[model samples]
Target: MNDKNTTQFNHENVKVGEETSPTLLRFFRRKWLGIWQSNPPGMGLFVFGLCIAVIMAIPIVYVIWRSLFAGIDRWQRLLDERIPQLLWNTLSLAGAVTVSTMIIGVSLAWIVIRTDIPGKKAWRWLLAMPLTVPPYVGAVTYIIVFGRSGWARDLWQSTPWLVNALGDYSINIYSFGGVFLVLTMFTYPYVYLIASASLRKMNRNYEEAAYSQGMSTSEVFWKVNLPLLRPAIGAGGILVSLYVLGDFGTIAMLRYVTFTAAIYFQRASFDTASAAVLSLVLILLTVAILWIESKTRRKNKYYQTSNTYRKPLTLKLGKWKPFVLFYVSVVFFVSVILPIGVLVYWSRIGIRMGALDGRFFGFAINSLKVSGFAALLCMLFSMPIIYLKGRYPSLITKVIEKLSYAGYALPGVIVALGFVFIFNNHLPRLYGTFYIVALAFVVRFLPQAMQAGEASLSLISPRIDEAARSLGYPPWKVMLKVILPNMLPGVLAGGALVFVSAIKELPATLMLRPPNFDTLAVRVYFEASESIYHLAAPAALLIVLVSVVPLRYMLKKY
Candidate 1:
C-alpha cells in the first residue's frame, strides 16, 4: 500500500487505518476534485445538472415575465380580491386531505404491519389498488350513487326524517366537502405506501423494549412507534401535499377550484397571461412546502440498519377484531368496492345495449399509447439523472436532483400552460401533439423514477461497475451489462406507477391534445359530463384493473 493509504478511520475503542494530518487531507481532497474534473461521467453529470436547471427555470421565467408584462394590472386587482379566497380554499382543502389521509392510511398500515390482520395479503393488494382509479372516476360513482337519481336517494324518499337527510342531500358530489371526501379517500395510499414500508422494515426491538416497560400496545405505538416512523411518514406527507397541490381532475369534477382549476379556467377564458401569474403563485406555495420538508427531513437512516430485525409483535384484538373489521370494511366499501361496483353495473348495462361508444374506446386507446410511450420515455430520461446523482453526488448534482420538484408540484393546467406557451411560440409544429402530452407526463413523474432508481442503486455496490470496467467494459457497456439488470426491478416499478398516473391524467391532456384525440381519462370526463356514464364505466374499470396489477407488485417490494 502507498504510505498515504494508511489514513485512518477510527471507531470507539478501535483503531482503523492510520490517522492523517490536516494538510495531507486537504491535498487528497484537491486530488479528488482533480479526479472528478477528469472523469467523463462527472463532467457529464455537471452538464446534466445545468440542463435540469434550464428546463425547470423555463416555466418560472415564463410565469414571471407574463405576470410582469401581461398581468400587471389584472394580477394586482385579483391579489386584492380573489387571491385570499383561493388561498383559503386551496390550503384548507390540502390541510384537511393531508390529515384525513394520514388517519386512514396510517391506521390501515399499522393494522396490517403491526397487528394480526388475518387477510393481510388481500388487504395489501386492495389498499394499493385504489391508486389506479383516478379520483374523478370515484367522484363520478359517488355522484351517481348519492345524487338525486341515486339508489339511496330513491330508497329513503319514503321515511320523512330519512327523506330530509337523503333528498335535500342530493350530495351534490360537486362541492368543497365532496372534494375533500373524494380526494382523501383516494389518496390515503400515499401515506399507506411510505408508512407501511417503514413499519415493515423497522427492527422489532424498539417495540419489544417499550412493552417491557409495562406499556400497553397503544402506549407502545404512540410513545415508540409513531415517533420513530415520523421521517417516513413525513416523506409521504410531502408527496401528498405536492400531489394535492397539483391535482385538478377530481377537484374540478367536484366543482371546486384550487390554483390548478383557476389556471385552467384562465387558459380556457383566453387569459394565458393571468394563468401564468397564477402558476407563479402556485409555485411559491409549493416552494414553501418544499422548504418545510427540507428543514424537517434531517438525514437519518430509515432502513433495517441494525442486527435486531424481526417480525413486529402483533396485537391480539379479541372482541375488538369485529370493530376493526367493520371500520376497514366501511372504508373499502366506500372507496373501492362501491365505485367499482357502480362501474361494473353501468358497463353491464352498456354492454346489453351494445353502447361501446367508439369515441370512448378511441380515447382509451390514445390514453394507453401516450401513457405507454411516456412511461418508456420517462424511464429512459430518469435513469441517467438518477445514476449520476447516486455515483457522483455533489452540491450541483444535488440541486439538479431537486429540480425535478418544479414539475412535481406544478398543477396539470400550469404544466399545460407552460407547454402551450413554449411550443406555440418556440416550436409551432410540435404544438398540440401526443409528444407534448408525453413530455408533460415525463415532467410530472420523473422524480418517482429517480426515487426508485436511487434506492435500487443503493443496494448495489459500486464495485460491480468498477469490476465491469476492469474487465474492459466501457462506461455505457457497464451500465447496460451490470447496472441495468440490478436496477430493472425498481425502474419497472416506477415506470408502472408513471404509466398508471399518465392514463388517469386529464387537464394536461385536455389542454394539449389536438382536436379529436382522446385518452381513457378524457373519455371518462367527457362521457360523464354528458350524462353518458354508461359508456365511460367500462373504461374506468379498465383503468383501475390495469393499475392494480402493477400497484400490488410495487407494494410487494416494499
Candidate 2:
C-alpha cells in the first residue's frame, strides 16, 4: 500500500509541474507578443520613436552627466567667480524683457483688438512683422543706427548743437540698455499675437456683467479684460523669458555678458568642464523660470465657463483715436520699418558691391544645404512622434513627445555644447561636419515642426487610422500612405518654418560648422563682427525675407 501511494504522489506531482510550466511560458510569451502586436504602434513604430527620442535626449543627458563629474574645484571656482554675475545678468535681463514685452504687447493687443483703430487689418500684420526680423539682426540694425559710427552718432556729431547738448554721441548700443531695447522690440510680438487672439475669443458676458454692476470702462478693462488675458500673458512671458535666457547672438553682439555668452567664451577658451558646469546652471535657471511660470499659471485659472459666447464690443477711441493710431504706427515703425529698411539699404549697397557673387552664392548654397536637410529631417521625424502621440495616447508616447522638445527649450549654445561633447567624444567622424550642425538645428527647431504637424494631425480622426488598419495597413504604413498625404500641407509648412529657423541659427552653426564651411548665418555673424556690413547685409536680408514665411504662418495660427 505504501509503495502504491508513493507512485501516485509522484504521478500527481509530475502532472502539476507539467501544467504550471506551459502556463508560465504562455503568459510570458503573450506579454512579449503584446508589445509587438497588441497596439496600433507596433514594434517598428515604437522602436523608431524610441530611437529618435533617445537621440534627441542624448545631448542634454550628456551635458548633465558631464557637469556632474566636472570636478568640485571647477564648480566652486565658477560658482564663486562667474555664477553670481551671470545669474544676476541673465535673470535681470529676462525679467526686464518679460515685463517690458508684457506691457507693450498687452497695450498694443488691446488697442488693436478692443479699440476702433484705423486699418485694423493692416495694423495687425504690420505689428507682427518684427517677428520676421531675428533679434540679432535687429541688434545689427540698431547698431548701425546708434553705435559710435552709426547714423545716429554721425547725425549727432554733424549737428554741433546736439553734440554739445548730448555730450559726445553718448548712445552706446553695446550696453545692457541696448540689449533690453532690442529684445523688447522684437519679442513684444509674442505677447501681442497671443493677447490679441485671447482678446478676440474672450466671452462678452463678463464685461457686460461688470457693466451691469456700474463698473467704469477703465475699471472693466482692469478687472475683466486684463484678468482674462493672464493666461496668454503668462505664456508670452515664459516665451520671452526663455528667449532672453537662450539668446546668444543678441546678447553677445550687444557685448552684454549672459550665461550663453559666457558659455560660448568658455568653450572658445577650451574650458570644456567649466562650460559644462555653466550650462548646467543655465539649465537650472531655465527650469526655475518655467516652473514658476507653470505654478503661476496653475494657480490662476480664468476659464470663461459660460456656454453662451458673444464677441465683445469694440470701443470707439473717440478723441484718443489719433493718439492710439500714433502709438500703433510708432510701434510698427520702430520694430518693423526701421530694421527692415536698414537691411534693404545695406543690401542694396551690398549688391552694388557684388555681394551676390560666387562667394555669396556659395554661402547661400551652404545655408540651403544644411538648413534644408534639417527641415526635411524635422518634418520626417515629427510625423512618427505626432502619429504615435495622437493615436496611442500612452505614457511612452507622452515621454517621447517631451523628449523631442528638449532641444527646443535649450539655448543654441548649450545645445551646441552638448553636441560638441557628444560628437567629439563619440561621433568623431561627424564632429566638425556640417551634418552635426544640421542635426543640432534639427534638435533646436524640431518642436516648431512638431507643433505645426500636431496642429494638422489633431484635426484628423482616429477612425481614419482604424480604417487604414482595417484595410491591412500597419501603423507605419498608415502614417506614410494615408496620414502623411492628408497632413502634407501642414508638414511642409512646418518644414518651411524649420528651414527659416535653421537659416537664422547662429551659435550652433558657429560651434559645429567645419572649418571653411561657412553658411549665410556664419558669414553674417563674422562679417558683422568685423564691421563688414556689405557682406553681412545680403545674408541678413535673405534671412529676413525667408523669415516672413513664419510670420505669415504665425498670423494665421494666432
Candidate 3:
C-alpha cells in the first residue's frame, strides 16, 4: 500500500509541474518583451524606425564628434581669432532681423486682419508673396539694383540733383544695414502669415471687455491684443532669427562673414579641424537660441476659452485710410513687385542673349534629378517615423521623431561639413557624388515630410489601425496599405515642400556636388558671383517660380 501511494503522489506532482510550466514561461517572456513587445510595433518595425532615425542623425552627430577632437591648438586659434567676430556678426544680424521682422510682421498682420484696410483680401496674399522669392535671389536683385555699377549708381551719376542730395550714393549694398534690410523684407512674411492666422481666430471677447472697461481703441490694442500676440511674435521671431543664423548664400553674396561663411572658407582651405571647431560653436549657439525661445514660450501660455466667441469688429481707418494703404502698397512693392520685376527685366535681356542655352537645360535637369530623388527619399523615410510615433506612443518613438529634426534646425553648412567628414572616411564610395548631395538634402528636409505626414495622420482614427490589425496585417504592412493611402495627399504636399527647398538649397549643394555637376542654385550663386547676370537671371527666375509651390501651400495651411 505504501509503495503504491508514493508512486501515485509522484505522478500527481509531475502533472502539476506540467500545468504550471507554460505559465512560468509566459511570465518570463512578458518581462523580457517589456514596452516594445507589448506594443503594436513588433521588433522588426522598431528596428527599422530606429535605423532611419540613426541615419538622419549621423551627419549632426558626426560633426559634433569630430569637433571634440579638433585639437586644443585649433580650438584656441579659432577662439582667439575667428569665433568672437563671427558670433558678433551672426548674433547681431539675427537679433536685428528678428526684431525688425516681428515689428513689421505683427504690425502688418494687425492692419490687414483687424482694421479696414482697403482690399484686405488682395493685400493678404500679396503681402505674403515675398516668401516666394528666396532671400538669396532677392539679394541678387538688390545687388543688381544697388551695387556700385548697378542701376541706382548709374541713375545717381546721371542726375546731378540726386547726387547732390545723397552725396555720391553713399549707401553700400554690402554693409550690415543692407543685409538687415534684405533679410527683414523677405522673412517678415513668416511672422505675417502666422500672426494673421492667430488674429483671425482670436476671440474678440477680450477686446470687447477692454472697451467695456472704458479703454480707447489704442488702449485696448496695447493692453489686450498685443499681449495676446506674444506667441505669434515669438514664433515668427524665432523663424526669422533661425533663418538669419543659418543663412549662407545671402550673407556670403553680400560679402558678410558669419560662421557659415567662415566654416565654408575653412573647409575650402582644407582646414577641416578649424571648420569642425567653428561648426561646434555654431551648433552651441543654435542650441542656446532654441533653448531661450523654448523657455520664453513655456513661461507665457495664453488660451482662449469661450463658449460664445465672436470675431473682432474691424476698425475704420477714417482719416488714416490713405496712409495705411500707402504703407501696405510700399511693402508689397518692395517685397514682391521689385524683386520679380528685376528678374523679369534681366531675364528678358538674357533670353535675347541666349541665356537659355543647352547648358541651362542641363542645369535644370540636374536640379530636378537631385531634388526629386531627395523628395522621394524624404517621403519614404518619414513614413516609418511618423507611423511609429503615432501608432506606438513611447519614449523610443518620441526620441526617433526628435532625432529626425536634427538636420532641419542646424545650418546647411554644418550639415554639409558633417557629410564631408562622414563620406571622406566611412563613405568614400559616395564621396563627391551627386547621390551624396541628394542624401544631404534628405537629411536636411525629412522633418518637413514627417511634419506634414503627422498632421494628416492625426486626423486618422486609431481604430482604423486596430481594424487593419484585426485583418491580420502586421504593423509595417498596415501602415503601408492603409495609413499611406489615407495620408498620400499630405505626403505629396510635404514632398512638394521638400522639392522646393532642395532646389533653393545652396550651401549643401555647393559643398557636396561632384565635379562638373551644377544645379540651378549653384548656377545662380556662381553666375551672380561672377556678375554674369544674364545667365544668373534665367536661373534666378526659375527658382523664384519654383518657390511659389511652398507659398501656395503656406497660404492654404496658415
Best by lDDT: 3
True lDDT of residue 131, candidate 1: 78
For model 1, the local distance difference test gives 0.79
Candidate 1 TM-score versus the reference: 0.87
Give me the displacement of residue 329 in model 1, in angstroms. Answer: 0.7
Q: Lowest-lDDT window of 10 residues in candidate 3?
A: 31-40
Residue range 1-558, candidate 3, lDDT tens digits: 999999999999999999899889988778655755576587778888899889889988988898899899888887898899999999999999999898889989999999888889988899999998889999999999999899888888999988788788776999899898899999999999999999998898898889899999999988888888889889888888888999999998999999999999999999988898899999999999999999999999898976888988899999999988898889888889988999999999999999999999999999999999999999999999999988898778889988889999999999999999999999799999999999999989999888888899999999999999999999888999999999999999999999999999999999999998999999999999999998999999999999999999889999
* Pairs in clash, predicted candidate 1: 8-17, 8-18, 363-518
Q: List the residue pairs that clash in candidate 2.
A: none
lDDT of 3 at 107: 87
Please write out the lDDT profile of model 2 over residues 28-115, one tens digit for every residue.
8787656435564777988998899988988889999999999999899988999999999999999999999999999999988888
Model 1, 1-558: lDDT tens per residue?
554454432242143223445667888878777755644463454565567556755655666677667745887877988678889988999988888888888899988777777797788777876777788899888878876677766666656887666445455666888888888888888898889998887778887888789999779888888887888788778778877888887877778878888888989998888787788788889889888887777654344457667877777878888898888888888888889999999999978877676765677789889999989987877776777777666665677777765676667777778888988999899997899899888877777777777789899999887788789876656666789899998888888888887887889999999877888888888788777878878878888888775576667666
Cα RMSD of all models vs. native, in order, equals: 10.0, 3.0, 4.3
The segments of candidate 3 whose C-alpha lies over 4 angstroms from its true place after superposition are 1-37
Which model is ahead, 1 or 3, in terms of TM-score? 3
User: Which regions of candidate 2 deviate over 4 angstroms?
Assistant: 1-40
